[model samples]
Target chain A: MSQVIVVTSGKGGVGKTTTTANLGVGLSKLGKKVVLIDTDIGLRNLDVVLGLENRIVYDLVDVVTGVCTPKQAAIKDKRFDGLFLIPAAQTKDKDSVTIEQMQDLCEKLKEDYDFIIIDCPAGIEQGFKNAIAGADKALIVTTPEVSAVRDADRIIGLLEANEIEEHYLIINRIRPDMVRRGDMMNVDDIIDILNIDLIGIVPDDQDIIISTNKGEPAVVNPKSLAGQGYRNITERLNGNNVPLMDLEGNTFLGKLKKLFTKKQ
Target chain B: MLDLSRIFGRKNNSKDAAKDRLKLVLVHDRANVSPEFLQKIKDEIMQVLAKYMDVSDGGLDINLTTATGEDGKSRVPAITANIPIKSIKQK
Candidate 1:
């Protein structure tokens, strides 16, 4: 059975969709059959992020409502053969789908795929609850800003209250330069505040915006730092002890020394 | 006596300001008591205390401190109340 992972943030615009898209591609590149599902419903954007918008003939609502089969709604990615996307219904509201419906859909998908990643909507509302209902684990995405960190804390509290185990944190849009200058919160600072297991740290790269605009996730681009970070996260998910990426140049030498010492 | 110069330093002053803000907010959030509501509660608590002891007005301090559990997963916020006995003496 596939492990269903929900990528969510209580606040919007914290790179939840981007993280979902890239992680989907990253896992697929690792030879895992991955399916990315957008559960935002009315305000769907995962289709656009995955560059599968034009091909979304049927949506998650269609499959859940019995209007169409799951096979019909699942859009296979052209860039990666094993990766698939189940786009959210742009016309229907989140009320159209129930939590049980989502759980059933995911259970069915789990039979065929190795990883089922759900891109959840912002806020702790019905949409958020529905997205997480079927998830085996959760990834709380947050930026380094104070508000984002606070929101992530609240989301963690909610998850714990719901008795959901196996939730981790992904600090996205980290500006290493700002962190070095004490202008932005670092990984340690965020982890201290949220108090969750760190799964990944993606740097703030301009290439992300460009790639996102082009309907391609930054993870596929080898030269993008963000892409490398996502790939490292993917390896870590597969139980590989991949060393965290050095964002600031100051840590490069230390990391190199550690690598050499490990070899010895 | 505390070192006046070091106590008044910019870094120390800024740190104090941040700590005060965080403490106030946390106390309010954990107690579900707003500033106005806290003032009222303080007044009522003082009135109740005054029945047995003479208490000074606006002399009570309350703060929220975190208590960590053995499992590291359980963290509870507890209210720490400080009421000076000297202040409670009859004036």
Candidate 2:
């Protein structure tokens, strides 16, 4: 069965696009057909993340406006099989696509793909509504910051209000060193505050910067910790029971030392 | 009022400060609490406090805030009202 998941974080610059790109790559690596739709119109970046910027002949606006079909607008991933991206328009307004069009587009694509991952824009605006119109589930992305977590809580409420109840959390950009030093919010604190099921915990790895700049997702790099985290997320999202790979334990000072001592 | 710095002392750890703060923030956020909601709460509190003693209406200060318990591990959202007692009333 196909799953339409909307990846959203109400606050901007919290790795929504990055998560969308990598999860698209990660799911496809598991041999599932995946299509990523970028709904952040006029500020499109998914194409650049997937290294398909130069190949976009038609965008999501074109597809939804009936100017082009979904097939013609989707750009296949250069590195992975069964992975495609439908990028947003760079010149159009965020309100260009109606909710009905977005839902219809997802429904049409669901038949041909195993997963339709929609990258939701920042804030609880019409863009967010458009992205989540046909979503079956939601993956809320948040960093270990007060602003991000607060927004995640609000987004969860919005998701529930929209009747998309099967929502999960993905805590991104965690710093184990800071967490061990008692300076950063750990995974448990965020999960406890948000009160949601965590699908993955991505560490703050420098490799993400390197991979992102190269237009290659961190999931493509086996040595990248972020890659492993995304893979674990894909596994758990696929219904595999995987123990969380967070660097800290339930207690602050005890288990965190053991986990990081081995790494250092 | 939530004494944020004390809860974030080295022994308490700074991360807990964030968690506790977020807990209170979400409670207010999720409840859809507004200035008007707090005013309504304060108004009801005033009616109850008036029965026991005379309270200085001008000095009344009420708002929704957080307080860390004695354990310091569990922080909860609370409604605080600072009503100055003007005089005692007896039956």
Candidate 3:
């Protein structure tokens, strides 16, 4: 059965959707049959992020409401063969689909896909509840800001209360320069606060904005630092001990030295 | 002569500033007690303590401290109240 994972954040606009889209593509690139589901409902944007908006005909609501089959709702990405998207309905509210319905849908999807990625909406409301209902694991995305970390902490508390302890942290939009300058929270600061397994750390990159606008995930662009970070996360997900990409130029020389030592 | 201006110079320490802001907000959030509410509580607690013994009226310290778990699973934030007794000096 496919591992159902929910990408969520308690606060809004912390790159949950972006991370979901890119990670879906990243995992698929690793030859894993991946399905990305948008559980946002009414305010769907994961389709736009994945550039599958124009292809979405029958949405998640359609599949849950029995108006359409799950196969009909699933939109295959042309760029990646094994990747698919189940977009959210733009008209229906989050209350239209219950948690049980979401669980049922995910259970059915698991038969075919290797990974089922749910793009959760902001806040701990019905949408959030529905997204995580069938999730075997969860990735909490948050920025380094105090407000974001505080909300993430609250979300972690809620997840633990719900007995969903298989969750990890992905610190997005990290500015290493600011961290070095003592202007922003570093990885250690975030790890100290959240106290979760660090799955990924994506640096703040203009390439993310550019690729997002162009309907391409940054992970596809090998030169992009954020892309490299997402790729490293994919490797980690596959049980590889891939060292994190050094965006701050801190580990470049060390890595080169290590390569020379291996050659020797 | 001491350089008093140097001693009292403006320091734009953003890290310290951010830490102060976060500490204040976290104390309020973890306790679910606003600064105004805390002021009231502080007064009431001081009054209640004063009934039993003499407390240093305005010198009491009430703050929150956070500690990490051994396995780093979660943070443990606790509220601490320190009230010093005003000793009556022998005349």
Candidate 4:
């Protein structure tokens, strides 16, 4: 089934873009045809994160404005045979594209791809409405910080209000060490407050900076903890009951515990 | 070894504190209630209570919080007000 998923967080700089890039690439790596849409508009950066900045000839605006087709704007990622990205325009803002245009774009792309992941812009504005218009599911991303969780709560409410019922939470940048020391919010603590289902728990790893620096996602690196987390998320998204990552020490016992604590 | 947590006023885990604060803030956000609206509600409660009892306004604290349902898994918006009553009139 072709699924349109929107990656969003009400607050900015909370790993929405990173999760979108890594999840899209991870699904492609797993042999699923995937396409990512950078809906951040004027402040677009998904292309740079995917290392396709120098190849964007046409953009989302051009496709929506009839200047070009979705095929022309869709940049084919060389790393994956079935992966593509529709880069957002750097000069035009969010208002340039309406919600109807975005829906039409997703409906058109759904004919060719298995997954269409839309990278939503921060805040609850026109950009957010446009991003969620065509989405069948939503992935709410947040870090362990209070500000991010608060914004995430608001986003959840908005998603419910918008009638997007199939939503899941992705807690990104979770620090197991800080969580163990009682200095950061753990997965249970966050789920208790947000009252949402879990899908992904990405740890804070240095590999993220290294990958972004190289314009590549961390999911390609098997040794990277963040990469493992993203890969697990891809499996879970595919309806597989994979065990969660043992974030404590990444040991054999942690893996055993993960088997018993598999979340839906 | 000496314990400095009590001196620093951290008797509970910081993550617990963070979770508690996050929940409290979300209650306000989810209710879409501002401090000014809360003050208005408090003032109205005081006006109605003044006819029957002497309610201490300075020490009164009114907040928007969550109320769990019978299942305890479901939650809804609830107004929690703690008012210190000084006297009551015979009615």
TM, chain A, every candidate:
0.94, 0.94, 0.94, 0.94
Docking class of 2: acceptable
- What TM-score results for chain B in every one of the models? 0.47, 0.61, 0.53, 0.75
Give one digit per residue, the lDDT tens place, for model 2 in A1-264. 999999999999999999999999999999999999999999999988888899989999999999999999989886799999999999999889999999899999999999999999999999999999999999999999999999999999999999999999999999877876778988778887888988898988898888888899999799998998998999987879888885655456546344444331
**Taking the tens digit of each residue's C-alpha lDDT, what string does model 4 give over B14-91?**
888898888778878888898898899999999999999998879898878888978987777898899999999888
Each prediction's RMSD over C-alphas, in Å, is 5.7, 5.2, 6.4, 4.4
**How does residue A143 of candidate 1 score in lDDT?**
90
* Model 4 C-alpha lDDT per residue in residues A1-264, reported as the tens digit of each score: 899999999999999999999999999988999999999999999999999999999999999999998988899999887999999999998899999999999999999999999999999999999999999999999999999999999999999998999999999999876775668988988998899999989999999999999998999999999999999999998879898777865655445544555454
Best by TM-score: 4
lDDT of every predicted structure (CA atoms)? 0.81, 0.88, 0.84, 0.90
Q: What are the models' TM-scores?
A: 0.83, 0.88, 0.84, 0.91
Candidate 3 B-chain TM-score:
0.53
What candidate 4 gets wrong by more than 4 Å, as runs, is A249-264, B1-11, B73-75
DockQ of 3: 0.18
User: Which lDDT tens digits does candidate 1 get at residues A112-138?
Assistant: 999999999999999999999999899
Task: Select the stronger candidate by TM-score from 1 and 4.
Answer: 4
Per-residue lDDT of B27-84 in model 2, one digit per residue for the tens?
A: 7997788988788888888898899999998999986776776798655667787889
**DockQ comparisons of all candidates to the true complex:** 0.14, 0.39, 0.18, 0.41
